[model samples]
Target: MTLTHRLLSPLIVALAFSAPVVTHAATDPSFVLTATSKNFDNYFPSYLANGYFSTMTSVRGSEANLAYMVAFMDYAKDDIARPAAIPGWSGIDYSTGKSTAGEFWLNRTLLSDKAFSDYQQTLDMHNGTLTTRYRYTDDSQKSTRIEITTFVSQADTHLAATRITITPEFDGSVQLSFPLNIWAPHQPRFPIGKMTGDEMLAAVAANNMSVTEPVNYRTADRAPVWYHGDTNVSNDDGSTKDLTLQLDGKAEQGLHMAEAAAIELPKGIKPSDITLDKSTYQLALNMKVPVHKGHAYSFTKYVAMSRESWGGDASATAALAKKARSTGFDKLLAAHQTAWHTLWQSDIVIDGDAKVQQAVHSDLYYLLSNSTSGTAWPMGACALTPNYAGHAFWDSDSWVFPALLLLHPDRAKPIVMFRHRTMQPARERAIQYGAKGTMYPWEADPETGIDYTPHFAYGVFREIHVNADVAIAQWQYYLASGDSAWLKANGWPVIKEVADFWVSRVSYDKANDRYEILHVTSPDEAYDDVPNDSFTNAAARKALDIATAAATKVGASPDPQWADISKKMYIPFDAKARRHLDFDASVPHDKITWMGSSLAWLMYPNLDLPMSPEIRKNDFDFQLEELKVHGNDPNEMMMVMLATAAAEVGDGKTAGEWLQRNLVGFLKPPYNVRSETASNNAGYILATSAGFVQSLVYGLSGLRIDDNGLTEAYAPALPPTWKSLTLKHITFRGKRYDITVDRDAAGNAKLTRKAL
Candidate 1:
């Protein structure tokens, strides 16, 4: 389907979208997100990622000035424990800090100093390529048109390339200098504190506080720079320098990272002509471009970033850059395009609404950009950025995994593999907490499965739902893929351990004859230290049930206690209101906070709880009213979930309205990328993106995944303004299918499924 729609809402359309100038006619105009060089600044960043590595640039022409790259594997130890500091509760390092993998850029000051005109940057969402074009005129009025095409190769995960082509009106030299630097920005280790910045600095100067030392270079010269530092520091009270102490390490101690670039010069320029400028933590490649009038000179720079976590050494990383340089740019571009094309095969097609189609594609595109097969690390909240300290939470299992599992199961493996890889740590954590089974942390360390939740947050000790969340994600993957080997090897163990954790956690109330999980935080995160949270109990019950069945699948004896616990699990409900209570003690029909309500999970993703239409409607209505309240900030994921709930409750108008509000409120153009909150707090939230896509695929299509396999739970509710919604290449049980939902002549929603 051709994507050619204007924004549905005029108020939400960005300035770039309103007057889009497609400088590249060969590329699809609908897939291209374009903005002027002036649109970019320190605050407004434009970025590209290829699952392995990502680069963020401030402007159109170069990756200079406030530009950096982050590899998925690059992480440093968070400031948790040190010799002089108050001992951290968890002895292990969280390793949640996402240090800069590398930075490579042409000298922006030198290039932008010359007079330039018609500068524009366009990101092709369909092909995963970014192209920037401009014409520079010298003092003699001689013009040179320069076009730079950049892409992190999806085909070859470790390789990234930038192709620079220049055509000049006069024969002259264009000096080009490229620098590679590996560094991270300075920020407080503990961000939340009561003390003033100046006071904290004074305390540090007075030897009352301590900070992580600066990074020390181990290897630096003409080759890739390798460095590490000590993150351990002295602790302070919540009111003091703990929040003021700046973390100085660029790379973590155990994470071996090496980055270098190889330049493929034009035919006339010799390799030996380029000069190398070296520093302690940086390397520069300097040369001059020999420009001939009306003769185009093309040069490609290949960058390779390797980390020990992702299976690469210094020699291997350098060899990758060299190999990519030898392979040439055209072949690499073609391979990258092919990889993207394969991913786009499983796409959401919205008929009669071009803007919605574009938005959906952009969301899926970003998720795909941040994923790859055979990796055990979870995608962070801000997929490529260091926002939220790059920690993976329940967001990965509950929101992000579903969409990927349905569309691209191979890519979805990492989300579950990460859990399996960290299960040992989960067991160790449970032992430390005096619990029987595995307990996944609320906020996990990417490298080691350490509980990264700060000691102050109750989630560090009380939020236990992540265990079940991980188990449910694993079972869902099994249901979708039907991979028996994976079930026995990776899936069953996690599921069984989660069941064991719940077994050890619940209290046996013989008087009430029920199993109760006490003092836990639900997905809502508002009601802490509560008993029997509706979502938590339901999820845990479902995990137990899955474990019982998985035992049979893996040819292991079923744990009898799992069935008993699941059968007697006490889920909070208000009989009079006919709605599941947020927690056992939550008052029915009380004034509610405008934040997200976890009750929606029962209707959308889980579907394990037994609820009548009246109950679902009551809960959804109450939550929707809470979201509508003006003062509180409601996240985008819940809005998407509520929209799906609206559809399930036969409220098509409400569903359509909420979906529209989400598109307008959370997603920003010209790229239609989603921020964490409606207030534009954090950019490129993959959870929000995943939830939006899930709302369309599973919500609008009425498809539900369970042990019985993929089945339509009910008739889909088509959005009022939508002509039709079709999901292509939906893989279930190793078969691909296309499902389309549209209104029949009678104005009733109809769903058609075709096997491919």
Candidate 2:
């Protein structure tokens, strides 16, 4: 069997579940994700994020050394001039792996075997909290239980808190330790050829590596530059003279991270001793706490991490940590809960299928957690890991931004602003490519506002559709938001420039009397340098139309050619077959690794490329059947597009099956964190989550955004198992509406819209 066939096995199994599997209802206040030893791999722990910071930890406290923590930093030039692994916030001591135990682990108090029982962790999405509890017996045969609760605050973007509570079965004294350390040092990882001249000199000087004929240095993998804190001296130093030299000047400029932490003891309790280790710069606190049976004593730790590269102040970090400690965990948690509660107001409600409802909730939670209103730092495709070098892509505007625009326009605004703020770089990129108007890069760097696409990928030059994607998001934001002031200030510039670009990009065929976009990469990614790709052509046409309307709304003269270009945009279609082709010369049902849905997007979202129901059904049948014939495994967004297109065509059964395929293919267990593929190579892809959620809002409910604003485009086509599907608090034209799609006794879906 081919690898693609193996990838489809999960979807095949999902087809077996014709009936609803009984599960906890999403409405249950206690509906929370629980993590166990069996649920998550130790290496890749479950994740928690709040836009600014993210943390991952295992249930076994003993393996706390392996915990991962990262905070958002504005882009900076470090060891290399390209995308590389930036320093994390796990602390200098934490990265060394010397501390086998964590702050939660009881020091020298457990039995000889040191085994823990009844370990479980509950992740409450509503509160954005992770609560871990476990019990262990001491050498005295006395039972003790510990609970640790952690959260990255939504109220304060810089603050993170962890509160630990201990209860003793009998009256006994236990020793506890708290750690304070600087942020983890930068350990640069990148190809040597990607480094600048000064970076190479520094690396060669520090590592004593030979670099003869440096001008002709081969592009090869190099060891990460070891930035050692005083604590790491023991691990790296041999002689005292060498150690002194390394400590004095080895650390590079623009790489230092300023981190501060404070610990708050319970009332009437104080630490027995406080000591700081100079070697590791790790502060330790030894506290003997007296506890009675059934009584709990708690301590909270507050940490604030920032970086010079991120424009962070060391004093501010210390002050923030101090403020959080004084505010106490109860109040901090309350504020965080209040913030998340307000965000969750816009939600997806599914009845009769608890599993689907839970998955939707998880999707909403992750997307919301990865984005905030005021920052221009858009979310990457994958939220947790630096997948694709943490660079924003069309995924942000095309997939993630659309999902948020309907539910939370406030969060979506920053995504568009990210593009607006980087327009200078885009203009420069256009000049670089000899194109008219602004040309947004395929991979956008947040800090530098430059195209971060590596030299290896041709996408920087060929993936020209990103310009249209960016403009579509801006115009859609204006239509949904009804923010004319913003449209004038931010939206007009982007849309107008994009319009000028399309005017310059298209070549007029005087003989054919039409315009065409040639030598482009379609979203399918399988075919590159193709002429008049259907998805690109349709999007370009839509973008031109949007640009024309935006210019009119903003009191700017509309581009004369925009209308002509949009009217005569060459979208490849087979007239006799009544089906759309991927390109001017294309074969239907060809083996596309990134199969299906590129053409489907033109039908469902764009709603252009005029096709009849017969054509739509033919396209849907061919795409679905092609998945099995040549071992074609489609991407997550493709599944969403197929599902949405099927729903638009009133094929609820096929749409429902595709929805099930998405759930089984991408979403993981315990937490519905989505993977890029069914094989789970890159997990926590926010774009997949957004696409799945989009189907629930726009597909099942049959909602579409147009000049008239949030109107029903087609009949609701909900899955058979889904008795009712509701999109609550959808914002459009400065108003909120609740849309419910319900199936009648006759088994036909009906939709109702209620304004709030």
Candidate 3:
């Protein structure tokens, strides 16, 4: 069952998906990809969320030349009503790290400006690399071909670079037009806002849409001139971000460059203009170059999309990007390759199954691409997708935090620290929302950890359990890192603030003689304003306990409220069914069709509620029924939990079944899209991967972090179908450990540690 490695896309890929699943290196080896597209899509899967560019195409890998950046503003974090009235743009990210929202200045066609035919495209993804090749014919029936390689700068977290090679069949000129489009962010009627069609038009006419003024790009004093500007961007949810974009290309020596108005270009007047009006978003850059039949033209474009709040001068940043491009592309690529190697070196390794290993690595690759060290932008729900105004969601604390905690704690710290930094806004919101202490936002981001979840969804109003989830992540971080220094400095304060929030957020019910959370959305999110949900209540109770324990550990007094609330918190129990109900029994719990495994969360990660084996079985049986009714494989985040539960209860067969279903259903057989929902692709990066890895470590292998190095409560029950299960080089508190579980009558498994 040993696996062999193979070369892919100029590097060694250790696994494959074909029969037997392992092979030696090949010149043209298969790739483990996020899927390359034939056409450009805003939501196309990206190669490296680690960089600041999107490399997605539709059916055939076509650039289509559209760009959007993510940035955040300090204006209003929780103000969604009449968002168009906001004055400035505040957003985050443009393929690299968080930047100010700026215009991408899309071009209609570059290099091949005229009508062409027989278009052909090819794309490849190896690990996290995406390469796209395009070919077409110009209006004169002359053949043209180009290859573009895009990557976020590993050397610089906020830069992206592309190397383009052009080859033509005829000696013709290449002209590019930077025409303002109907859909770029600069347009007033851009569909990024909540209002669409007539409503959007009305908003735009009223000058209240999330739009930037038409600011034409300008040229700096260098060839492949650096052009950058700032513009206002708004979202429906009270967000105003000033984003900036940069475009600087180094063309061949025999090329000529000119800039003019899009309308003037039609007249072919060759206007002598080097500057543009601030009101013109569409400015054209024309390049005329000599082409020989067999010679190829090559150039590199360096770009940086930044936001005002990011604090870096966009113009200077753009200029720096261009300067870096002056160096050979191979040099930049070597640094980038080293970065990926470092990430992979620190990753969790799986042995015995090459296909399963590749799938795991794919999940991990997206995780690394989407998160970086010291960047406050936790992997947003959709990683880089524009949802919740590009804000980090609760998915961060619960899903993203744990996996990075186990493998890349450096990246995981930002997830937890973001809560700490945003606590002030959270507390202010708590007071504003008529609650106590710091209540973390569901759609949290920079500017403030403000709530960006829409009001209609009931998440902002009632899904208050996110506070506890934040605390849970903090607790897990401490356990993994044993960083008491960090605990005293940052972790404890957050624990205290959140614990204070939950204590004041809960209410005492004189009628029932218990503590209850009312008008709340449970983690399932399918139902709203439910009372006394077992998941939420249990989580709240755990939050209090964590706060108190953390306070004591930090030489502070434990909060008395924590004990009082947790002791009396109401948990919806089903006496007849021998399990827990979705909500309080008195609230018609039987009538509700809950859609997730939040209760299962209480069993695995939180373990807030005490349960017997039979009770666990009954709970799981009911959850199976819920999945039968509504859990769509493409979007659901519970298969990992089910597998964890199965492993927790010592059901090896069931655990293996759940794992196989996830591999086949989610990653390979049915839909390998990684994500089905655009609402927040963070689920793809965090929920899917974290849950899978957590199930293996904490579920099947029964591994739990303790003060005494590594410990396991139950011998891992390896499924008969698997030859063995092994994890290599997992980091905890600056140390690395490896574990292997082999199926034998004695249940032989081994754990080893690196010497300090």
For all candidates in order, the CA lDDT equals 0.66, 0.65, 0.52
lDDT per residue, candidate 2, 484-594, as tens digits? 999999999999998888888898988989999988877666566778888888889989999889988988899789999999988887788677777786534365465
549-604: candidate 3 lDDT, tens digit per residue: 88888999987978988889988887898888878766543432324445666666
Residue 605 alpha-carbon offset, candidate 3, angstroms: 2.2
Q: Model 2 segments beyond 4 Å from truth?
A: 1-31, 39-44, 61-114, 137-143, 169-173, 180-188, 192-257, 278-295, 305-312, 458-460, 586-589, 606-610
Candidate 2: pairs in clash: 231-279, 231-280
RMSD to true structure for each model, in Å: 11.0, 8.3, 12.1
lDDT for predicted candidate 2 compared with the true structure:
0.65
Give the backbone clash total of model 3: 50
Candidate 3 local accuracy as lDDT? Answer: 0.52
List residue ranges in candidate 1 displaced over 4 A: 1-28, 37-43, 65-116, 137-143, 184-250, 270-273, 309-311, 586-596, 629-631
**Weakest ten-residue segment in model 2 by summed lDDT:** 241-250
